[model samples]
Target: MNITESIKFNKLKEENEALKEQLEMAHYFNQNLGKELDKLKQQILYKEDFDVLAEMYYDYCLKDNSKYDKLLSKEGE
Candidate 1:
């Protein structure tokens, strides 16, 4: 190839390599974001379950609802 052609080919090759690297980085970021979202979903589910259990305890085991109210107020503070 002529010198100009060789230079153009090298430039294209470098651009291709740069694009591949960017794609790899984007894939890695997407995977990590998915993992973090899963963790957040699990935490929300856990919190819902715990809230249900707490409500059941307050409704059945406790004679006075005032204790539950106090706990709620403490949390707000």
Candidate 2:
């Protein structure tokens, strides 16, 4: 292959490798988030006091808006 062809091939290969790493990281993050959500559900399930559970749920709900904003910005990128 000529020098130009070699350079193009190397660049494409690097981009592909970077994409694969990002995908792997995303998968790992998603799996861990799922585990955490499941644990939170269990905590709510095991809570005997209805008032405490409700308060916890309410406090957690307030964070949803910020989470959505971050998700939107990430998606836009």
Candidate 3:
């Protein structure tokens, strides 16, 4: 290949590697954020007020947490 083409190819390779590294870091960060959010949610459920608990329960409903209904049932019982 010509000198110019080789330089362009190297630049492209470097960019691709940088993008891959960035993507991996983003995924790792998102995963950790998700875990931290879950922990914060648990803390909220235990420590926060009822309105916050209700919102958390709504989110739990989307996840189909069966414990929510059980808790409600026991409350009514």
Candidate 4:
């Protein structure tokens, strides 16, 4: 190849390598985010269960419906 052609080929090769590195990084990030999302989902389930138990206690033990009513109000909002 001419000098000019060789220079262009080297530049293109560098760009290709850079793009491969970027793709690998993206794949790693996606996997990490997926794991985080799974953890968040488990946390949400725990929270929902706790909320239900608390509401039951408020309604039956305390005989107060105000908090439950407020919860419903917040849901609407």
Instruction: Rank candidates, TM-score, best first.
Output: 1, 4, 2, 3
TM-score-best of 1 and 2: 1
Candidate 2 residue spans exceeding 4 A from truth? 45-77
lDDT (Cα, tens digit) per residue for candidate 3, span 1-77: 99999999999999999999999999999999999999975653321244476786775433664644343322333
Q: Report lDDT per candidate.
A: 0.73, 0.69, 0.70, 0.73
Write candidate 2's Cα lDDT for 1-76 as tens digits.
Answer: 9999999999999999999999999999999999999998656422234346667787654435453333222223
What is the lDDT for 74 in model 2? 23
Clashing pairs in 1: none
Which wins on lDDT, candidate 1 or candidate 2?
Answer: 1
RMSD of 3: 11.4
For candidate 4, write residues 15-62 as lDDT tens digits.
999999999999999999999999975553333444678787876454
Query: Quick one: ranking by lDDT, best first?
Result: 1, 4, 3, 2
Error of 3 at 74 (Å): 14
TM-score of each: 0.61, 0.55, 0.55, 0.60
Overall local distance difference test of candidate 4: 0.73
Candidate 4 stretches greater than 4 Å from native: 46-77
Give candidate 1 regions above 4 Å deviation: 46-77
Decide which is better by TM-score, 1 or 3: 1
How many Å off is the CA of 52 in candidate 4? Answer: 8.8
Looking at model 2, the pairs that clash are none
List per-candidate RMSD values in Å: 6.8, 12.6, 11.4, 5.2
